[model samples]
Target chain A: MIDPIDLQLIVAIQEGLPIVARPYKIIAGQLDLEEQEIIERLSRLKQQGLIKRLGVIVKHRRLGYQSNAMVVFDMPDKLVKQKGEQISQLAFINLCYLRPRRGELWPYNLFCMIHGKSRELVLQQLTQLIDSCALNDYPYDILFSTRCFKQRGAIYSIDK
Target chain B: MLSILHKQLLNNFQQEFPLSPRPFQDIANILGVSEDEVLSAYRELDKLQFISRIGPVIQPNYIGLSTLIAMQVPGEQLSAVASIVNHFPEVNHNYEREHLFNLWFVLIADDEHHLQTVITGIEGKTGIKTMQLPLLEDYFINLGFQLDLEDNHQSESVCT
Candidate 1:
């Protein structure tokens, strides 16, 4: 668990970093902490694997990646780790994970996201992924997103 | 249309962004452009909604608990159900996908208890059962996207 001050720092920057000459310094002013402290804490947090990345957050759809599909596969439990690692290394696949199967309601255990400029392009990439990964035997589903109701960064409550 | 500098900035700086007092300046030095040029380009990118923000993408389940949830809602009641789910700050990403369990969303909370409470509250409000798919393993190392700017087409609005 992180300390209170570190948690406060996460809360401050979770939304975004100010786009300025000295963004960290600006955050330092807000938290009444030294600029170096903010930088050091962020570095440590990043090294500790709490922070995945620190950079530009591109809106893929705006960049013409309109075709987004969540492709899920029902793989043998033993092969999940190996298959997940192989599928994730592909350049087209953005995110991959292993999730629990909800019995008959949901049987998919492996999931990955692919975004492309068109549906045709996405499907073609999916075909390539299947061929390359030798995943013909697994039952999979492609759930293309129809609409986005809401999208934003996660907000963690500091009160807790 | 994106300028060369704009494309470079978008493609190259997706991750490992300069963490310093004058990060824009640092980026400027690397790109062989003036600091003002880099700053203005980023501002333009933000205004155009090409980039969401400059911030740390926290690793999942690090600072708080989160899970992927899927709910099967009646076709007509989809909007209403989504609105109810969106009311909670814990629900960050909510989407309508092409599947029986159509509404897929992500919920993040300060702890496991809070996470369960939000899930129950959503079910209570919408009167629909939600299948929680918590992450069992993350196979992908999220090295931010290497955007292909040249292939990008003008995006048509997908949001209702």
Candidate 2:
């Protein structure tokens, strides 16, 4: 289990690691710990699956991926796992996961995000995904993002 | 247009950030630059909002509970409704989608009770029913897109 110090460190760097020559050294100074200690603790957090990956977050829209669509699929529970693997491997699909279906209201059990240069291209890729995965019978809807309201890293605090 | 350093940084550092005492130094060595140059480039990229952060992208539903909630808001009240949802810190990502369930957001909380409470609070404040869809499975998690800088720049120049 992560102790208080490690939890605090995780919270501290959730926004980002310092963009300095010696980022750990800077973080270590601020946290009143040794730079090596900070690195070891971070490695531990990552090993424990608390920290997923240490990487850079790219702005996809600025990179020319203009079209973004959240596609929801109503697939059988037995087939979801089998088909989800196939669907997620498609080049256009970036995010694919199984989400619980809301009865009588929303019946989509599978969700995937496809991004492309245009809506038509995204739709074409979706068609390709559907045909290749043999998911023609499943009912689905494409919800294209119209506007981004809020996008920020999830901040974790000690208190609820 | 992506500069030589920008292209190299974006392509190389998106995944394998060195787990060392001085990661920027390692990058500097790879790209044949001074560590200070690497640091400034990172700062510039961040300042320009080309990258949101350089840190761990924690996996969802690991330490806490998270749900995708959608709301149907009238066109006139979108701003008001969005502001109400955005007021909560738990709502990390909020977006307007082209569907009857137009407004969608992801809420993360410490636990199930906390998650439910936030959803309830949103319902009370916005007077809109939220369709809760929590993840049941993950097929693909982080599929980072590598930008084709050449094509992207060429297209932008043509458009402009």
Candidate 3:
């Protein structure tokens, strides 16, 4: 579990780091802590795997990655780990996960996201992924994102 | 229409963004550009919504609980249901996809109870059943995407 100060620090910068020469210094000032302390804490968090990534969060759609498809597969339970790892290694696959199936309503247990410049490119990549992985037998579906109602960094309430 | 400097910053600095007193200056030194140039480029990127932010991508279920949820809202009520779902601060990403379960979102909360509360609240408000698909295993360690800016085919549709 993270301490209170660390939680506060995470909350402070979770939204974003100020786009300035000394962003850390700005965060330090906000928390009334030394700049070095803020840096060290963040470094420690990253090391602990609490912070998965620390960097530029690009808006892919605006960067010409217009096709966003969430590809899910209903794989045999045992094959999920192997197949998920294999699919995650592909350069075009942005996100991959193993999720639980909810009976017949949701039969997919594996999910991956592919973002590309166009629908054709995304489809080609999906085809390549399927052929290379030998996933012909597994039932799969590609749900292309039509609209983004909202998108933002997660907000953590300290009160919890 | 991204400048060379902008492309370099977007592609290379997605991960390992400097954690120092003058982080932008560090990036500037590496890119062979002035600190002000890097800062302004990033400022413009943020202004144009090309980059969302420079911050830590917290690991799921690390600081708080999170789940991927899907709901099948009728086409007519899609916008209204989305508005209700977007009302909660916990709901970070809400998207309309092409599927039976057309509306999908991600919710993060301080704990399991809070997460469930938000889910239940949304169900009550929208009157649509939600299928929670929390992460059983994450196959990829997010290193950030390495963008290929050479073939820049910007989409005609504006995503707002």
Candidate 4:
């Protein structure tokens, strides 16, 4: 079970941390706790796998990476494990995972999300990835996002 | 294109941001800049949505059930359907993609039963067929993109 202060910490940083030297100290002051306490709680939260990693989230679109595609592959179950690992190692692939196939309508099991400056570049990279990774035989489709309705870090407000 | 300092911040902090109480101070010291400078720069970056947030990115499927869902909505009802999906607390990311299955969203629920219930509820409300793609195997995720700050160009600021 998470303590109240821990939940408070998550809520506070849900949007972001303040851009200050002593960010935790400032948060501690607001929460009426010592700086060390905030640091310790955060560390524990991370260790417990509740918090994955603390880092910067660069907006890819803002960095001229406007073209993004979700590539789904119809991979045989036997080869998925081996191929998924290889695909994930490729430099341009940001997210690569395997999802369950949904019968005839959706036959894809392996999925990857790739981003580039333009659609042509993204497709070029995908073609190269397919050839280099020997993934040419697999049937796949790419879905390019037209608009982002909402995007944010997961909220842990739901009772665990 | 980004300024030298902005580039430095993105390059350094994207992966291994300091976990210290005075992390900004550490960054300032590393860049030979004042704490205020680092603070204000980050503030501007956040305001501009250059970075979504500076914190821990939770590992999906670790805490709750999550799935990628896609729906085919008429173009005229796109906004309305998107708003409906956005209203769900379980949804973290939602988007409109250029495909027959246009609207896509990621939903996180406490368990499989809950996930199914939510999917059913969404289908009933939207009167659209929904496709569920649950993760079967994850090979890689949360990879940060490295930007070449040499261009020194940024998108035109959108006045709020």
Give each prediction's DockQ, rounded to 2 decimals: 0.78, 0.55, 0.76, 0.61
Report clashes for each candidate as comma-separated counts.
0, 0, 0, 2
TM-score for model 3? Answer: 0.96
State in Å the error of residue A104, model 2: 2.9
Give residue A62's error in model 3 in angstroms: 0.8
Weakest 10 consecutive residues, lDDT, candidate 3 chain A? A151-160
Report lDDT (Cα) of residue B100, candidate 1.
Answer: 95
What tens-digit string does per-residue lDDT give for candidate 1 at B39-79? Answer: 99999998888888888888899878999999999999999
lDDT of 4 at B123: 88
* Cα lDDT computed for each candidate against the true fold: 0.90, 0.83, 0.90, 0.81
Candidate 3: give the clashing pairs: none
Candidate 3 residue spans exceeding 4 A from truth: B153-160
By DockQ, the better pick of 2 and 4 is 4
Q: Candidate 2 on A1-160: residue-level lDDT in tens?
A: 4488987787878889989778888888988999999989888777776776777877767667777899999999999999999887887788889999888668889999987877998999888988999999999999999788887877777666
TM-score of each: 0.97, 0.92, 0.96, 0.89
Leading candidate by DockQ:
1
User: TM-score: which is higher, 1 or 3?
Assistant: 1
Give fnat, all candidates: 0.85, 0.75, 0.84, 0.74
- Docking class for candidate 4: medium
TM-score of chain A of 3: 0.95
Which lDDT tens digits does candidate 3 get at residues B66-121?
99999999999999999999989899789999999999999998889998999999
Candidate 1 Cα misplacement greater than 4 A, ranges: B156-160
Candidate 3 C-alpha error for residue B100, in Å:
0.7
Candidate 4 matches the true fold with a TM-score of 0.89
